[model samples]
Target chain A: METNTKILACEYQYLESSELGQVLTWLEEYGEKAAVLAGGTDLLVKMKMGNLQPDCVIYIKKIAELDYIKDDADALRIGATTSLATIERNEVVKTYYSALYEAVRSMAAVSIRNMGTIGGNLGNASPAADTAPPLLVYDATLKLVSQQGERLVPLNEFFVGPSQSVLKPNEIIAEIIIPKLGPDSGSSFLKLGRVSADIAKINVAVYMLRSGSKCESCRIAFGSVAPTPIRVPQAEAMLNGKEINEELLGAAAQAGAAEIKPITDNRSTKAYRQKVSKVILQEALQAAWQRAGGAL
Target chain B: MERKWVKIKVNGKERQLYLKPNDLLLNVLRDELGLMGAKYGCGIGECGACTVLVNGRPMLSCLILAVTMDGQEITTVEGLGDYDQLHPLQQSFLDHGAIQCGFCTPGMLVTAKGLLDENPNPSEEEIRDYLRGNLCRCTGYTAIVKAVKEASKAV
Candidate 1:
């Protein structure tokens, strides 16, 4: 490959965990002037496109402590640097976060997943991010750390807009905390794309708690149909405590379809996406409901 | 900008080089080490033309930085076998009519080698999944799959 050397100097600073404190200190000193590199999947592309040019890149992949996937008492704490391929193949991830595993499998081909990190995907904050909807349904929280300290924020509130996140310039997403599913909880993710392995034109994730044949609590989230991954409270309210039925599913789907403001993009038409999104949401909810031990 | 010295073991031989700030593994292997078996079809990670074994794992050389590969065992298509004694996969590729223009053959062979190294006996589905990253414009993948299957028995 020909070197694109026309672009001026872009330096890489490799930092092990022992050097993390110094790196954080440097970021604190420089503030927005530096960029943290977890996985080069996204940052490298942006830098090549001339979209980003940080004075320095703080390479954090060498920090073994940051690549952990630990089981917290009430949740699964996934390190920000965890590769998407690892998440897809992990036994615990497949068992607890089935929707996330399924969603990740549907993302770009295996090569990209091997290099892309969950934190990089979230930090990239694309509207069509495959992992966002599943994470949103699980009520995942992000552990953002800086020189000052660490703070936890719900995943739904993480993305402010397309290509924008609530993360601070100097802070890094250290971990993702996914709350443990209750005994009767089940979840499912559904995505519609042009190809079998393409970014979703529309994606939906449903998390439901069942009591016999009834839904005790529910969360419904949608992606690529809005500016950010959207949690449909009105739709969830329609399904909460309700039994699975054609009418209820239709009502919930309609509610979710009514909340989104999709636009005509190169991927799919606005009208077509809006119409197909409702169908996908219904299918996703039914699957989640069935997994929760609810009767169809 | 400062340079980083990375010591890599290529095909069982250790070599050291001082890489520039943004030098990628693909550059070091092709330019510095003079191993041209790994072709550069796409600078981006989309194509598997630059696939090489980094510590025995098939990875896109275009995406890996030379500096991050310090003290790593690297294997290219050339490392597998030479023209005098072709690897089983190379022989199979020739026998099964797997190569057309031959631009994508080296990558396919290396990727197949990686898969077979871990799994000597793989199902048709498993073989397809492992080669999902490799794109072949010719032969429609039937010959490629057959070639991998044949190499499994030999290697």
Candidate 2:
């Protein structure tokens, strides 16, 4: 029997740093030559494919400070290296951030989730990343650290393009801060994939806040429909302050479909994505509205 | 790259080996330790043929650097059972005719062991969901699902 084994060709020094200062120093010294290894799910695969050949692979899993999920006064502070499984099993995340929970749960499968990290997910910056749309809907902020200092970047503005982010060579994502939802707010995430565990062809996340029978606020985000995960501000504007019903939802969905610029890929066609985006957005809106104590 | 010496527990046995920085756990288990049950179906993590248990959690051995896994407990399919003394899952797989070509069996068995250890009596849907990563081109999954269900009854 023939085996499909991968022999990583490049020779790189491996540095396992247990402290933030050590990581910063290594990053400062090596700069772009130093690649951070969080869970090794993305880095190792990229290395095997010869897409990335760095002089040094810095293993940051040993840094104890970068592996935690804490509930702050008004937000959840998640360490960048926290595993997807950890976030999926978090009670607070499951109860309050259902969109994130569903997105994390929908990522890959059990084994990959066990070995994949949220920091790596954001760092990889794939427009189709399952966690991006949900984070956009939650208004999540990412904290990046370097020898100079720390800075927070809004999740919406983090991704510049596919497999690209605004992160500098010296900076690393340290933490993710997600604000708590307001009262009577609910969120939902839906994705269309070739298989249950495959990468999403298109995904949508919706967060809605209800004030009596009218919509107080609504945020809609789509993934795999553009060069980056984008917020449908026009769609949100159409639904905000309007009494959310099937008619309003349909109109908003149409508006959202019109707003996104999807390209034809091997996984899906532009027409299929355009049609499915509206359907998914409608389903997500209905689910979020129902969760927010709305009848429909 | 410098070769580092590390100690890891494999199948309840401690092993110390000199490994390169890029040596994956999959190669160490197959070449160095001579445990070849875990097949390398996909070098990348898209396929679960390299699945193994690290500290009781299922992970792709191909993606894990052996140097970083020092002092961790590792469980491969060889630890489950042999032909003479079959584990309940192995026995169930045999009884339910879940083995076909047998390329993905080791990974499936190990992943199922991880699932059954966490949830002794899992529903059919839960079993299917947990085993979604382990792909078997044969068996069509009906018998595989039945074997897991049968193993759950005995476990």
For this target, which candidate reaches the highest TM-score against the unseen true structure?
2
Q: Runs in model 2 with CA error above 4 Å?
A: A1-5
Residue A146: error of model 1 in Å? 0.6
Residue A59 in model 2: lDDT: 91
The reply for model 1, stretches above 4 Å from the true place, is A1-18
Clashing pairs in 2: none
Question: Cα deviation in Å at residue A249, candidate 2?
Answer: 0.5
**TM-score of model number 1:** 0.92
Highest lDDT against the true fold, candidate = 2
> Candidates' TM-scores?
0.92, 0.97
Q: On residues B51-142, what C-alpha lDDT tens digit does candidate 2 reach at each position?
A: 99999999999998999998899999999887799899999999999998999999999999999998999999999999999999774599
DockQ top scorer: 2
Instruction: Put down candidate 1 lDDT per residue, B1-155, tens digits, no spaces.
Output: 57877788999999988876577788789888899878777666666888888777777777676777777899999999988999999999999989998888888988899889889999998898888778887745999999999899998
What is the Cα-based lDDT of residue B103 in candidate 2? 92
DockQ scores for all predicted structures: 0.42, 0.77
TM-score evaluated only on chain B, model 2: 0.97
Q: How accurate is candidate 2 locally (lDDT)?
A: 0.92
